[model samples]
Target: MAPTAFLLVFSEPGPNVPEDEYNDWYDNEHIPLRVNTPAFLNWTRWKAVDGEKPTYGASYDLESYEATKKAPYTTLAETRSDREKGILANIQLLDRRHYELIEPHPIPLRHSTTRRNLPHTSSLSPEEDFNKWYHEEHIPLLAKAPGWVRSRRFILKDCGQMGVEAQKDQKPPKYMAVHEWASMDSFKSPEYKAALATPWTEKVFANVVAKERRVMTFVRKWARL
Candidate 1:
């Protein structure tokens, strides 16, 4: 069976807009509009644990690639367009992207994860250091981590008009990557603990990423056909 995928949006409204007001608009108005759409299957919202700014994360899952590819966009498009026209008319308010599930290697259950690294903003300069650690060190170590099946990584290219600007010219992030896990408990495994204890993982933290990073996690929900 094909796995469900989500289009995620993480946003921080304009400075003048109160966080509660933004949350209210999203929970009361925007999310309901999207959920009512034929293409949207499930929706959820979350607040960030660490940010001083009022942060909001929203997710929308589609039944399948074919279903998502064919859904009516008039209402969806107009709603997003109008929102952009409002408080976010000029500022880029959030990180947005689409994620799909891939088969896990050794495990029977499905697993999902996505990673996005901000360019130039990362504390780890000369990204090659981070790259080497991720592919050469981190992945190999993770393979031994329990419940880790198979993992695939992809470079996010342009989403065409699906991006915030709706202009092909507006480039979002310079790079994006993803990792898959067999189950949520995989993180609690001994192998994963050992991997985190490794020197490579430590170096990655001290050298690559800045204190601030944007990470999002989601649970896959198989949509009804």
Candidate 2:
């Protein structure tokens, strides 16, 4: 199936830059420019109410995989202005991740899709076998909820780590899973809770080293479909 990809950026302010200006550059300048692109269909910004390290996050839904690699998108980093360049220097941490939709072929999701970023450092079972169980066993069960629209899994693509500083003691998550729901209210249903209570879910949850989750709604969406 053709996938709906997301370009997600997680960032925090540098020691010297003003918080308000940093926000303006992202909200008013950077985000607006990218959303205007033909490939970028929708945008949603979120604040980290639960996690540490990344204080802010934004996700842009792509029309296609080719959109991310094509002109304008590819040239964006190289074409940064002097003001954007200065802002880049002052940003302390920037982590970028790409995710592509993996489920509900034929029927497209219509509302907020819950984004779950999970990285497993170790597991009781072998790494290869662990993923096998997730796709065949875990994810299928979780999507059984009434509001569960669809789900997708993503692998990290190595690119543009320009200003990022990797920690010697830790590494980024190897996989990210995006689950779509008809609405936020769908998450509270009894069916959703039951799906998560399965034994396979318990086993997988035990081995996760670090995970980050964020809820987001589209501010603006542009598309042909």
Candidate 3:
């Protein structure tokens, strides 16, 4: 079967770097390097409205996580011009990871005003049990939240560090869920709160060894299916 994956990145400008210059390089130079690749289906950018730092996030929908380790994708960075390196040197990457789709949602990919990103790792429960809760119980409840568009889940396949002052050999959680929304209203809604209040949710989440919750608003989209 054809593989499906995501290249997710969170970042911020380095100290003394102006936001305009950082964004200019990302929009005009950095992102262009990956846009034309056939394996890359689409790319979207976002800014944090709430939650974790590094503030900026981007998602690259790809044919497979393995595509990132090959040919043009690898060559893009290896062959970066001095100017590209210069700009990269002034950026700070908070997290960079590639993940394969585990649970695909029905809603066609489209623009959304808000999103909630949950990246986590599990330790206590058996993998099957943890996933069973998410697949059979958790998502259905979350789906009932007002303004919810869709929710997709993924499993990490590869990860690496980037940018100046980047963390040394950093690693993120193994699983992630991307939840789309029409507005921020879903987060504080009764249904959303109730979803988290379930005893099953507590049981499963107790096994979540590490996690990050980031709420972001759409900034722009570069390419699409």
Q: Which has the greatest lDDT?
A: 3
Residue pairs in clash, model 3: none
Q: In candidate 2, what are the lDDT values of residues 76-98, reduced to their tens digit?
A: 87888787898887677776766
The ten-residue window of minimal lDDT in model 3 covers: 115-124
Top TM-score prediction, candidate number:
3
The CA-based lDDT of model 2 is what? Answer: 0.62
Which has the higher TM-score value, candidate number 1 or candidate number 2? 2
TM-score of model 1 (CA atoms): 0.53
Which is the winner by TM-score between candidate 2 and candidate 3?
Answer: 3
The lDDT, on a scale of 0 to 1, for candidate 1 is: 0.51
lDDT of 1 by residue, 1-225 (tens): 334554656676755556666666666666666666666777766554334432555655555545555547344655564554564554336556555533323323234343221111113434777667666776677778766655443333224332233344544443333434545566689987887688877877775433333433332222333
TM for every model, in the order presented, reads 0.53, 0.70, 0.87
Order the candidate numbers by lDDT, best to worst: 3, 2, 1
Residue clash pairs of candidate 2: 102-152
Quantify all predictions' global Cα lDDT against the true fold: 0.51, 0.62, 0.75
| Residue pairs in clash, model 1 | 105-149, 105-150, 124-208
